[model samples]
Target: MKLVSVETPEKSVCKMTFSASAEELETASNAVYERTRASYTIKGFKKGEADRAQIEADRGEHTFWYDAINDLMDKDVPALYDAALAEHGFVPVDAPVYDLVSVKKDEGFVATATVALQPELNLTKTTGFTTECVTPEVTDKEIDSVLERRRNAAAELVPHKGPAVKGNIVHIDYEGLLEGKPFQGGTAQNQTLQLGSGRMIPGFEEGILGHKAGEEFDIFVTFPARYHAKDLAGKPVIFKIKLIDVCVRQIPALNSDFAKKVANVDTLDELRAQVKQQLHDGKHASALNRAKDQILTQLADAAEGDLPSTLVESTYQLQMQQIQQQLQMQRLSLDRYLSQIHETRESFTAKVRTSAEKTARVRMALLQIAQQENLVPTEEEIDKQLAERAERTKKTLEEVKAQANVHAMRRNEGIRKAADWVIEHSTIEDK
Candidate 1:
């Protein structure tokens, strides 16, 4: 192989032209013929035994030319690109794009490979950024909220004979009619629904408010125009409700018995302490994450680099796929989610483009920092991470290995180490 010229026509993009020897071209052609000879037949030879010349004559001179050139390029271009990249001393962010210029039997082949390299940065300052870290505080309200949730979970429902209110479970038999005709899925017998839970239509819960048990009354409500049911959208429905029972939750007293039953703590004070500590730990973790994010953002903002479009697009698509997976887990469709967020596909992509570019830039900066600080993650670190991940996810080591992108994981560890280095080197103020 021979390198004709290497050019940097754009920031982060490297273009190289190279030529292969005729001998190498011939070898590649032979390899391609051997790989595909089973599908060819010649008059004087068996299917797989047909020689290259015979197949070419039977087909055309240009038949194997493209495949042969591709085979040679595929085998050689990446190495050639890597050598050029090494000479230039720049890391690539994306795979090289190859364009075959010419291919001939005796003249060999010429091709061009273009690649996107990590951009150079002129970081004003990687460190010495003054920032305040909030000391995570567990508020009394937060503790009360947790206690309320636990109390609600432990509560029992008892029959009540008063007007239905919020937090009360109402048992009712109802038949809904649209345009004076019964609609499908609009009738339920003795269904229990929590009032003011917003599980039903907007007005359904509100209409049931102040209604006592054993009352037969009509509740009028209109479905929203964006309702999932097309036929029922924006339609008025009258539900003839026969309230059978109203039940209110009986919460357990916040005593030692309650503490023992709820969280295995022997005393209420101990339970409160445990809850407060849990909340504090959670808040501290969240606050630390936010602080890290702020630091990264400041670093990224100060760091100057040309982002490769290919890497940006890849990051954007990966983010979108994650969003799709999350929506699927929530039993929602992407289209429905977009509608709820008041965004279109193009608009959402446009919005993601900005963050994607920033992410790519931040990743490159982190990698650069890792390299400068010699903060590469060791094999033992990776193994420990994988093991911990497998244990936490309840998956086998092999399963975790199969699902993980080794390159990304390594880079992640490197980034983590880089962040740690920055945190250690920089001064922090507690707020």
Candidate 2:
């Protein structure tokens, strides 16, 4: 075996010159012939009968035999080389091997292979990274806010014979038309509008203020430019309206009974305790995320080396795809989302690029740490992970294996292990 070329980190192309025995060559030739016979269905040949004429014709067709022989060699030669390498306690890198030979009677086929292996990562030590996270105390004020929302949610609406109040629910029939033509979704029948609720358009709820039941009127209004309806946007329209009834919100007293009704807590103190615990949990989660962000920022700053552009670009594309999917889930398109936010695709792309770059850097850093720590998953561990994944995804092991590439899965596991290690070793300051 002679080295043809050497690629970095366990990739190489090599040429091997060897003589094959007559029996060995005969075995290979017979294998190729059998494969060809099985693959092609020649008309005029009896079933399972060897057609010498057809075989000869096929051999004469250089392109046909060239592909056939090359494929045969491609599939069989690697195993032979691997076997040879095993004898020397070395494994052949997983790549295709080709044979180059002169058409001579006794000359053995000379083969060349381009091989690849897992890259060797030599990671440098990373340090000087620190993160400050503010875990806010869940105060009485925050708990009170949650309690107020709960109270409002359970508030009762009572018929108000007097003037409409701020929290009153007013029943009305309204028709909005643009250019004297009613647009789709621009009209509602006997819809309940809550005054000062901010549930309707900016000018809609206030337009019917101080109106009694059974009153009829038409109010001129202009649709905001950011209105969902494209046709009526930024256009002046008249809302033909009729007031049906008015009811005021009767807010429950902030007492034990109200707490029991809204939160299933027997007392207001219990409700406050529950709300405070929830607020504390939410605050802790937010603080942890902030800490992770700070850690990642520091790690990215400390990280040194050229990140593969291909990897970063692929990551960016995946992030963009996820964002688009989320927008789709909300029944909006990326364009519509940008329009709603008053942003362009370029601005979104820039924002996504920043996030993607940070994620890629952290991922690469974790991988390097895993390598340095020799934190590779054992074969048994990998199998266990695969089994769990199959169970979780409701797939058979074989089906999961077919769909989820095992090698990639292992690599991801390594990165996860590295991240776990980083979090375990890091110093966390609670505020």
Candidate 3:
């Protein structure tokens, strides 16, 4: 093969013209014939016995020509394209559309490709984009709430011989009636209810208050307007209640011994301190992460570049497909989902396009930053990433490599490193 010329008709488009030698094209044609000759049925010849010339004569003069060109397309064209781009120092962001100029048995073929190049960004304000971050303080009430949960977790259930009370677990047989008729999902026997837990309709649990085991009575309540079941919402109902049994919860006392047993701390004060510090640290880390996201978003928003239309369109299509797939998983139609989210098709499409454009900008900006700061991951890092992916998917490393898009993987990791770099180089101030 010979490379004739390389031209960039636009900043985002590359055009390359190349030709294949006659020997190469003939070899490819013969290879294609050899691979497909078994399927050819020639007159007075057994299957797979016909030579290329006989098949060609019976078929057409250009019978093997198209397949051979396509075969070269699959075999050598990509390497040539990459080599040409490398020599000229250009990286394509999207697939190329090719045009076949001419082809013949003697002269071989000449072709031209129009490729989309990745947009290089001139990134500004890559650091010190201030964002609001609140320093978290854990109140004593919050700490006490945590400790109270621990106490309840260690509580024991003990049988009660007499009347039920708030915080007592009760077993009962009952039927609920609306308009003097039993409704669907309104009857059960020996159903358990923890009084004051608010698990049942309001006034239903409190109705069991002071009722001893084996007592039978009727309690009335109305469902809340916002209830999930529309038929029952905001409707008054009568429940025939029978108390079968009751049990009181015996919660642990909050003390030094309780702290030592539950939290492995020497004293209650020490346990409180530990819980408070852990909560503050977790909240602080979350705040900082959100601030970092804001900073990078601003950086990408400030980045200057005209995104390639091909990349933007492809990304937009992919995102739309993904959204449609998600809607399918939820057993919904796209129109219905939009209605539920209060968006019309036009607005939704605009939103999707905006998001896709922003995504392209973010990627371009981060990659540029990565090039400038040397934050690109090494081969070992990529291998580790692949190994982690293999572990997560329960596949062998080789299988992961075979199925994974390695170039995308490298780009993603580099973008991630660049994002972290942007965050690390900036300071998030307290609001």
Question: Which predicted model would earn the best TM-score?
Answer: 1
Error of 1 at 325 (Å): 2.5
TM-score of each: 0.54, 0.51, 0.53
RMSD of each: 10.3, 12.6, 11.8
Best by lDDT: 3
lDDT by residue for model 2 over 1-431, one digit each (tens)?
A: 22223233322223344334434454555556676665565566665464545765654533243443455465565456556555544322223334465433254344454433222233444544556678788888888888788777887878788766676788888888878988788799889877998887767777778777778988787888988878777888888998888887887899998878877889989989988888888988899888866766666666765554445565688899999899889999999999999999899899898888777777777766776788867778888877898999999988877676555566678878887677666666777
| Candidate 2 accuracy as lDDT | 0.68
- Name the lDDT of candidate 3: 0.86
Give lDDT tens digits, candidate 3, residues 52-151.
9899889886888888888877677778888998998887765677889999889999988877677877776788777888867889999999889989
lDDT of each: 0.83, 0.68, 0.86
Model 2 segments more than 4 A misplaced: 1-124, 137-141, 152-252, 261-266, 328-348
